[model samples]
Target chain A: MTGNTAPSQADARRTVISVDAMGGDAGPAVVVAGIAKSASKNPDIGFLLHGPAEELEPLVARRKTLKGRVEIRDARDVVTMEDKPSQVMRNGKGTSMWSALESVRSGEADGVVSCGNTGALMALSMLRLRKLPGVNRPAIAILWPSRNPQGFNVMLDVGADVRADAEDLLQYALMGTSYIRNSMDLPCPRVGLLNVGTEEHKGRAELKEAYALISQNAEKANFEFVGFVEGSDIPGDIADVIVTDGFTGNVAIKTGEGTASLLRSAIREAFEYSILSRLAALLAYTSLSRLAKRIDPRRVNGGVFLGLNGTVVKSHGGADATGVSAAVKLAFLLAEQGFAEKLAARVASAVELAQDDATSADADAPGDSETGSTN
Target chain B: MTGNTAPSQADARRTVISVDAMGGDAGPAVVVAGIAKSASKNPDIGFLLHGPAEELEPLVARRKTLKGRVEIRDARDVVTMEDKPSQVMRNGKGTSMWSALESVRSGEADGVVSCGNTGALMALSMLRLRKLPGVNRPAIAILWPSRNPQGFNVMLDVGADVRADAEDLLQYALMGTSYIRNSMDLPCPRVGLLNVGTEEHKGRAELKEAYALISQNAEKANFEFVGFVEGSDIPGDIADVIVTDGFTGNVAIKTGEGTASLLRSAIREAFEYSILSRLAALLAYTSLSRLAKRIDPRRVNGGVFLGLNGTVVKSHGGADATGVSAAVKLAFLLAEQGFAEKLAARVASAVELAQDDATSADADAPGDSETGSTN
Candidate 1:
C-alpha cells in the first residue's frame, strides 16, 4: 500500500543494516569481523548485528577502528538451514532474522541484510513489509553468472513464483528494469524475456503472448525490450535485465555458479597433478585471482527484492566475511538512494499505462460481458 | 500413437543419418574422415552426405576409407550463417539444411543430424516433421557444463520454447525424463525443475505451482522430482534431467559455455605470464584437458528435439567437426534405441493421466484463459 519511507538525511545519523550475525558457516565471528572492517572504512555506516548475544557479544569489535560505528541487536533464536519458512515467521519472533526486517519497517534502521533461509526471508518480508502497489507478486532478483561488463545481469523470480501468467512477467520486467536503473545505475538497460529461442512463437503459449504484449505496448519507454533472449545469450552484454519464471531463473543462475566452481576445481586439480603443474599454479596464482575477481559473484553479494515497498538485500547463506561486508555496503547504497521508492514509482506508471489500455478494451467490449481471458 | 519403434535392430539394415557434408569449418573432408572412422568401427552404420555433387565428389578417403559406408546425396545449396532461417527454409528444395532434415522425415533416411544453422534446422524440422503424439510443444535439452564423474545435468527447452507455463513444464519433465531413460539408459532418473530456490513457494508463481505439482506426482512415482535445483546445482550431479522454461535453460547453457571460454582464456593468459607459468601450463595441459573433457558441452553436442514425431538432432550452429560428429553419434544412438517413439509413449501416458483432470477443469466454469494471449 505504501513505499519504503525515505529516511531524512537530517533526521538519520547513519545507515544501519541488520545482519544475521549467526549466518554463514564461519558463524557470527566472520560476520562481525566483516562489519567491523566495513564500518572502519566507512565512518558514516553503522550496523545492528542480530543473533545470540552470548557469541556475538564477545565477538563484537571493541576497537576505535570501528568506534561509534556499530551496535549489537541481540536476539534469542537462530534460524538454521533446516527451519521452515512459517516457523521462521511465527516462532522465530525475536530472532535475528525477524528483528532485522522489523528494524527496517519500524525505521530503526535503513535496511535489512540477511544470509539466513531465503524462503523464511521472503515469507517474512511479504508479511512484515508487504509488496508495493500493483505488485501482485515480488521477485528476488540477483546478478546471474555472466560475462557482461556491467558485472552480471539481474534475474528475478529465481524461485519466487511457479505458476505465473503474462501480468507477472510484465511487472518483473518493469521492476527489474527500474531497480537496475535506479539502484544499479545502468542507462537505458536492455530488458529481455528469457525464452527458449529468439523466435516470437517459441516458449510456452503464455510466453508468446507475453512477448507480444512487451513488444506491442512499448512498455518502460525508458528501457529497451530487446526482444527474446535465450540461455546462451545471457552471457553477452545483450540485456541488462533478463526476465523469466523463477524456475528457469534459479537454474540459470546456479548453472553459472556451478560452472565457475567447476572451473576453479578443475584448475586446482590441474595444479595438483604434478610438480610442473604445481609450479604453474603458483606462478599463475595472480592471473587466476584476477580472473576470479572479474567473475566473482561475491563482489556484488546483495540482490535487492525489486517491486517491494522497501529495501531487503538477500545475501548468500554460504557467504564468507567478504560477502557479508558487500551485502551491508550494497544495502547502504539502496537506502541512501531511496531506490525502492524510485522503482515503485516507475513500476506504478508502467502498470497504469498498461491498465489504461485494458480498461479501454473492456469499455469497447461492454456488451459481451465476457470474462477477461488469455484465450 | 506408437511406442519406441523397437530399434530396427531386428532388421538387417542400420538406420541412416544424413549429416551436413559441407558444413562446419573443417568441411566435408572432416565429415568424410569421421564417417569413415565411425563406419569402420560400427559395421552396421551408414552415412548420407548432403552437399554439392562436386564438393562431395573427390576424396582419397572416398575410395579407401569410406568406400561402401558413405553415400552422397546431391544438393546445390549450402546454408551459411548469413542466410536467414526463412531463406534456408524457402530454398529447402536443394539446400543442405533442408535436405538433411527432409531426408529423415521422408523416411529416405532414419533420421537427420546437422551442424549448420540452428534456426534453419529448428524451423525446417518444425515445418517438415510433426511433433510426437501428446506433445504440445517440442524442446531441446542440453547438458549444462559440469565436472565430476556423474556428468552434468540435462536442461530442457534449450532453444525450444522461449516462454513456458505449468503444462509446458510438465511436458518438459516427461520428455527430459524419457530422454535420460531410453537414450542414456537411466531408469527413473531424478527430475528437477530449475528455479531460484527449492521451496514449494519459491520462484515465479508458475514455477512454484509447477514445483508443487511435480513434487507431488514425480516425487515417489515414475520419476524422482528432486524438489528445486539452483543454477549451481546443474554441475554437481544433483539431478539427471533438469527442466526449466526455454529462457532460463538457454541462458544457463550459454552462460556456462561463455564462462568456460572466458575461464579458458584466463588460464591461457596465466600460462603466458612467465616462463615458470609456461612450464606449469605444459605440465598441467594433460590434467587441464581431462578436466575440460569432463566439462565439454561439445562432447555432448547432440540434443534431441524431444516429443517430435521422428528422431532429430539439432547440433549447435557454430559447431565444428567434433561437435557435429558428437551430435551425429548421439542421433545414431537414439535411433538405435528407438528413443523418440518410446519417449512419445511415456509423454502420452502422462498426458492421459492428466486428461481427465484437464477436461474437468477446462469444462467447468472456465476461468479467463490466455492460451495464446500476450502481456
Candidate 2:
C-alpha cells in the first residue's frame, strides 16, 4: 500500500542498507536477488551493494524491482569464509565487507548486512564503526524461534568473543535489553542470565557475580531480571532475552540448530515411510508447509552485532536469496527504528549509572572501600 | 528367551542393580514400575530397591515380575530434589540415594541406578566410591541419539563439574572411548573435542591445548582423534565421542533437548491444524509412531557417571516407567560387561602412558623440561 505513495516522497525517505554482495556462499547474484525482493516488498528500501562492479552490476540490472533503488559500490576484493579475523583486520581495506561497513561508518547507509565470515565481519565492523563507549565486548545476538508471544527470544554473545566476565555479562544484559526493545518492540524485556540451573547457588563463580550485577541493574536498565535460566529456557516462554558468554551461547545456538535439523529430516523420513504416509503427506501439505515456514532458519537469518556504533546484521554465509532477504528486512527494520544510536545512548547512560552507584557506595563506605575493591 | 533360563541358575548369576526408589518426580511407584519392566525383560537382573521398607514393599509387590527379583532396603530419609550436594555429602548417610550407592560401594550391587537429585547422587557417589586413580574430575556421560552407526554419540562432562582443564578434557576423551567400547561395542571410538569452530585455532586457550593433548595421545590410547568438532557435529556421524567442559556440555545437551521438544510440539500442532491434517495424522499413525520411537528421549534416559570406582546411571529425575526401565537396562548391560573395572584399568594405563611420554621427553631434553612442565 505504501508503494502507492508519491515516488519522490518514497525515494527521499528510502532507508539504504549497505550489503557486502560478494561475501555469501551464493555470491553476488543471490545478494542482488535478495535486495530486489526487499525492494519489491517495500517501496522505501534502497541498497548500497558492495562488490566488484563488473560482477554485481549485471546482477542488479537483471532485477526489475531494483532498477533505480540500488547503487553498486565497486569493491574488488572479497573476504572469503576462510579468512581469519586477525588477518582480515590487517589487509581488509579493499574487501567488499570493509567497503560495505565504510558506508555505515561514513553515514551514507543506515545499516549494513553481510553474509561474510562472521569473525572477519565483526572484526572489520569494530575497526570501522567501532565499539560503543564503556562496552567491553560487542555481542552477536540472534533471534531463536520460541514459545514466546513474539514467536522468538533474543539470545546474546552467540560468538563475538569466547569469554565474558561479570562486568561484560552485565553489559550483555543491557545490550540484549536494548536489542529486544528496538527490534521486537517490547518496552521492557525480561532478561535471563543463562546458567546450568535456575538456582541462585548453581553454576560458576563468574555467573553468580553476573547474576547479582544484572539483578541490581535490571530496574535501572528498564528490563525485568528473570534471575537464572537454564539452556532449556532459551526456547521457552519464561524469558524474552537469554544472556551468556559467547562460548556457551555459541555452543547452545549451534546445538539447537543441529537438533532442529535432525528432527526435521527425521520427520520427513516419517512422512515418506509408507504409501499411506506418503498419501498423508500430500493431504497435509499446506499444514506442513505452514509449520516449515514458521520454523525456517531462513526466516530468521540475521545475527545483529550489538554494542557497536552502527547496526550490522551478519547473515548466514550459506544463505540463499530468501535468507539474505530476511537479513536485509531485519537491517531495514533496525535502521528505521534507529536501533544502533538508541542502543548506544542506552548503554552510555547505563554505564554512567553503574559508575555513579559505585562512586556513591565508595563515598558512603570510605573506610571499607579497600575491601570493596576486592570484587 | 532369557526368562526361560533355569531360575536357580539365573539367581546364581543375576546382575543386581541398586536403585533409589524414593527418587524421581513420579515418585517410588514409577521407580518400582521401571525395575519391574526391566525384571520382566531380563531374567538375570535383580534390584536392590532402596527406600522406606513399608512404603516400597507394597509397590514392588504389585508387580508380579518383580516378586523374586527385588530386595527392599529400608532407608528412612529421602533425598528430595532441593537438598544441596554439599549438604547431602555431609548428612546423606541414611538417605535412600545414599543407601543405593552404598550397595555398589559394598559390592552388594553390580551398578547403581538412581532417578534422584543429580548433584546429590554425584556428590554421594564421589564421596563413597571415590574418583579413579588417574582422573582429576569425574564426568557425567550421556548417550545422544545421533547419525552414528551405534545410533548415539557419547558426550562427557555434561554437569559433573562446571570446569575442565586440558588434562581433564584428555581424561574425558579416554573415558568417553572406554564408554563407547563397553556400551556400544566400538573397539576404538572417534573422539572430538567440542569447540565453537572445528578450526584448530578457533576456540579458547584451554581448548587449543586440549586439542594438541588429545591429538598426541589418541594413537597411544587406541582411539581415533577427530581433532575439533563444533556443537552441530555432536549429532552428526563425524565422531562417536564428543568431549567438553561441563559448563558447555551441560548447556549444549539441554539446548538440544529443548530444541527437539520445541520442534516436536510444533509438529503436533501442524498435524492438528485442520481436518485434513488430522485425517493425514490418522493415516500416518504407524509411520509417525516409528519416527517418535526413533528419537524418543525416554528410550535413551540414563546419564552415566564416568571416572569413578563404581558405575552409576543417573536416570532423569522426572523419568516414567519406560524411562526408568531404559536406565535399568543400561546399568545391567554395563554391570554385565564389568564396565567400571575396565574403565579404571583403561584410565590407569592411559595415565601411565602419558607419564611415560613426558618422562622420556624430559630425559631427551633436560634443558627444555622446565618449559614442558609449564603446560
Candidate 3:
C-alpha cells in the first residue's frame, strides 16, 4: 500500500477494474480467461474478480498472466438471467453483481464490468452507485458500429428506462455526447434525436420539442445538433450520437443485432447451398472474414452505463472470451482516461444550462400548457 | 359497355385498380410501365389511369398490353411529394390523387393505387373512402420479408398515425388479422404487440394494458395472441402479424430498410476492395443475386391502407416497373377476394365485442381510469 516500494507512479495509478465473474451464460472460466487475455495484452490492467472464491481461485491460478494481475473477492450469491430488477433490488445483497458494483462504489475499482441481467445490474448500480449530480435519469450508452470516421456511433437509453420525455431526451443527448466525446475522443460530436422521419414537423409532439431543445442548446453543450434523423441514420455517419427513448432504442438495438445475426446466417447458408458456392466461399473467405470482423458484435461488446457516479460496462450475457476481453478493453480505456469524472462534470454544467433554458421558456410561454407538459 | 364484349363471366367481373400516374419520383413512366407489366401478366386486371391525358396518352400508347386493359381518366393536376396532408385536405380538388381516390369512392375501381405522397394519399383515401364503421383509427399495413413459411409477415401502422392507445393497438390487431387472413390465406394468424421486451411486465403502461386487452380478445378475434414481440420478430417467423404504434413501426421499418441497404452496400464494397475480391464476387455472383432477390424490397412493394371502406395500396414513390407491378398484383388479389368488405365486417364484429368487454370492465373496475384512458 506504501508508495515507497511501488514500481512507478504510472504503475501505482494502474487502472483496476471490478469484474463480476459469475452469472454470465458462459461460466466464470470464460471471465478468467478473458481477463487473462486482457492482462497479457495490457500489463497496466488489473482486475478485482468477484465470485465464489472456491470456483474462481483455481481458474485465476491456472492463468500465469492473470496470477499477479488479478485479485479474487468472494461472493456466494448469483443473479440469474431470469431474475427481475425488482427482485434483485429487494434481496441481492451477496450476489457477485452487487459486490462488483460495491467495489466501484468504494473506489477500489475505477470501473465495474458484468455480464449478468441488464435490468438487475442497472437497478443495482442505480441503487448503489447513485446517479451523478444533475442527472435526472441515468442512460445506458452503447457504441454501435457505423460508417463514421470514428467507426462507431454512440446511442443511449437503450433500455435504462422505457420512457424518455423531452427533458429526458435532452439529457440523453447531452449524456451521449459526453460518452462519445470521452470514449471516442471526438470533439464536438454530432448529436441527433432519433425519430420516424427526418422532417422537423413529423413524429411525436415530444420529439418536436426535443428537437427544439437540442437545437437551441447544441452550441452551449459544445456539440452539433443534426436536428432529426431516421432509424437508418443510427448506423450511418450522419450523427455521431443517436438519442432516443429507451423503448425505441432498446427495440432498435435488438432489431439491429437480430438483423445482423440473420444476415450472417443467411450468408453462411448461401455459401453452403452448393459446391460452386462452397468453392467461391473459400476463394472469398479472407474478404468475408474482414467484413465479418467489421460487423462482429463481439468486437464492441460493452454497453457503458452513463450518468452514474462511476463507469459500469455491461458485457453481453453470452459473451465468450473475445467478447469479454473487448468489454474489458473498453473499461480500461474509460478508467484510464477518468471518463466518469469528466462526463459527470460535463453533464452537471450542461444540465444547469438546460434548466435555465427551461425556466426562461416557461417564463416566455406561461400560457402554453403543452410546453408545461413537456416533462 | 364492359359486359357486352366480355370474353367470359370472370372478365365481366374484372378488378379495376385506379392508378395515380403522376408525382412519383420516376414520374408517370414507371406507373404506366408497371401497370403494363401487370396487365400483360393478368388478363383479369384493369386500370383506371389518373393523370394528364396529354402526358399519359403517349406513355400508354407505347405499351400494347395496356391498350385495352387501361382506361385513361383526363386529370390535369398532380399531387407533389412535398404537399402536406392538411394542405391536400383543404384544396386537393382536381388533383390526380384526389381523382384516383374518387374512382374507388364511386365504385368505378376495386382498389386505388398511387406512387405519390403517402400523407396526401392517406388523407385523400381517408377523406373520400372514410374509415370503416367502428374503426377509431385506420392503419397502413405492409408485408415485410421474413423467415416465415409464407415468406412475409404483416406489420401494420407503418406510418398511419404517430400514436396508438391500447384500444388502437387492439384494432390494429383485428384489422391486421383480417388483412393477413385474407391475403396470406392463414386461418389463424399469430398476432403480437411490439414492445421493448417480450416479458409480461415490461414496456410502457399502455403496452401492459394492450397485452391484457389483446389477450382477452384473442379467441374472439380468431387469432393467436403471442403476447409481446421485440423488433426482431418483425423479420422473424415468431409472429405472423406484428402490431405497434405508428411511431415505433415507422422507425423500425426505416431502420430495417436502412440496415439492409447499408449491409448490401458494405458487401458490395467488401467485394470490390481488390482484384481477388472482385474475382471472388464474380464467381459468387449467382448465389449473391439469389440472396439479393430474397431481400429485395421491390418484391413486396406495397403498403395497404387498412380499416378503410375501400382498399388502397400505396406504392413506393420511387418504384420502378417491377415495384409497381408487385403493388398492382397485391391490389388485384385484395380486390378479387373482396377483402375490404370482409375486413369491414370482421372489424365491426370485433369492435362490438371489444366495446362490450370494455363496458363490462368499466362496470366491474369503475375506479381504474388508466384502462378507460385508452385513446
How many residue pairs clash in each candidate at the backbone level? 49, 0, 0
- Residue-level lDDT of model 2, residues A244-302, one tens digit each, is 99999999999899888888888889889888888877877887897898778899999
Per-model lDDT: 0.70, 0.87, 0.84
Give per-residue CA lDDT, model 3, range A99-187, as digits (tens). 99998999888899999999999999999999998888899989887888898899988999998888889889888887887777687
Give per-residue lDDT, candidate 3, residue A204. Answer: 86
Ranking of predictions according to lDDT: 2, 3, 1
Query: What's the best-to-worst order under TM-score?
Result: 2, 3, 1
Off by over 4 Å in 3: A1-13, A354-375, B1-13, B355-375
Q: How accurate is candidate 3 locally (lDDT)?
A: 0.84
On TM-score, the stronger of 1 and 3 is 3
Which candidate wins on DockQ?
2
Off by over 4 Å in 2: A1-10, A361-375, B1-10, B361-375
Local accuracy of candidate 1 as per-residue lDDT tens digits, A205-230: 88888787777644334567888887
B41-72: candidate 3 lDDT, tens digit per residue: 99888888888888888898898887667777
Give all TM-scores, in the order shown. 0.78, 0.94, 0.91
Worst lDDT 10-window in candidate 3 chain B: B1-10
- Across all models, the iRMS values in order are 3.3, 1.1, 1.4
